[model samples]
Target: MTEFEHMLVNSFNTYIEENGIRAISYRLKQHRFTPQFLDVLVDSLNPDLYLGIECKSISVDKGANALYFSQHFTVDKNGIHQIERISNYLNKSGRRGFLAVELRLGTGHGREAYMIPWNELKKKYFDKDLKLTLQEIRSFPEIKREGKNYRVDPMEWERK
Candidate 1:
């Protein structure tokens, strides 16, 4: 995982801890299909919630408050494939999958995040560039990013 990815995981774990939830995050070293490897995995106790989080970062020099969801592959692997892998793992494990994206603006001083659920993501509902505005994501109270932490609202999370 890159430094940004590591930071994202840390932020998420911190949020979980601060919320009085027993959750821990671990980063997967290997990116594979089977056996289910992901960028970050959050294991929660008490209520028994498991989340598979995938991290992606974009530089917004133009101050665009949007997240660019990529599906095509050039140098790196296709993001959709990765998302599917995580989604499959979540399905098999009876958990939920989320995508955590970081957008850094001018001078890297401004930063925003969007946490999109697998169901909303798989629809390919975004524009031609697969971009979602920050405001659009904020409307979903259940799934949203607070600072660098991509998290599900505790109120919206179902108890098991």
Candidate 2:
């Protein structure tokens, strides 16, 4: 697991425990020769509130405002997708699918994290170039670290 993934998982689990919510977020482990389509699974007391997350990260220079998400398929195999399988399963009715992307701004500059909805990700799959620029990513919901944790949980999650 990447450090960024760890950060999100840690933050979410901490949120669950700290708030005394009846929920649990855990990373799915991969078995031998088996691929784990998603990275995180969040189960809540509310059946409709289940969440699935796929973690991805990229590193860019300090002053750069644009980076690219691996997204050129049929033309190349270097895209950031699981053949749309993850999106297909998690994006169905009543399910929550999310992308936890961390943009590392080199060393000492820290990192910028964003939680993008699956609908947003699916929209990019139809782009002519099939790529997402960092400028576009910044427009999504940005996540920041607070103290030892990052706030990655939804407010309604605490209501339970």
Candidate 3:
């Protein structure tokens, strides 16, 4: 994982811990198809916040072609499908889940981090639960470049 991806995982784990979640956990390069390889998993008796998280990072390449959602893992069809599968697993187990993308540019050009509801995903995409519409995720402020590094301020998703 890149520094940005590491930061995202740390930020998420910190948020969960600060918010009083028990059994906060995260993994990298893990197999999500199996129950044992979830990137992040929080087990809570509280229905409101019981969630599993999948984190993805976007890679930027210099080329004549313009940047498109399809070019990024977070916005690609496969990414969506992966999230949907996780969502379905959560729903079936009476829990909630999300696919969290840690964009390199933060909310670049007006994109944001969002907690797409499982129900909406199920309706739009089949029972697979891995696809997501652009409108599903919320955007955050853009990351600012500082020297050789980029900095992203802490952001929060508005409670629904």
Among the numbered candidates, top TM-score falls to: 2
- Note the Cα lDDT for every prediction shown: 0.60, 0.69, 0.46
RMSD of 2: 4.5
Model 1 CA RMSD to the hidden true structure, in angstroms: 5.2
Estimated TM-score for each candidate:
0.64, 0.79, 0.51
Clash pairs for candidate 1: none
Local accuracy of candidate 1 as per-residue lDDT tens digits, 37-98: 55778787543447776666666676556665543211224434444565567778766766
Candidate RMSDs in Å, in order, are: 5.2, 4.5, 6.9
lDDT of 3 by residue, 1-107 (tens): 54544654565566667776664445546454633323555565766545565555543222212222333323223545443456557767775655455333333
lDDT of 1 at 147: 67
Better of 1 and 3 by TM-score: 1
lDDT of 2 at 25: 83
**lDDT (Cα, 0-100) at 150 in candidate 3:** 35
Error (Å) of candidate 3 at residue 62 is 5.4
lDDT of 2 at 59: 66
> Where does model 1 exceed 4 Å of error?
31-36, 46-48, 62-80, 125-160
Candidate 2, residues 85-141: lDDT per residue as tens digits?
676677563557777777878867778888777667776775634556787777777
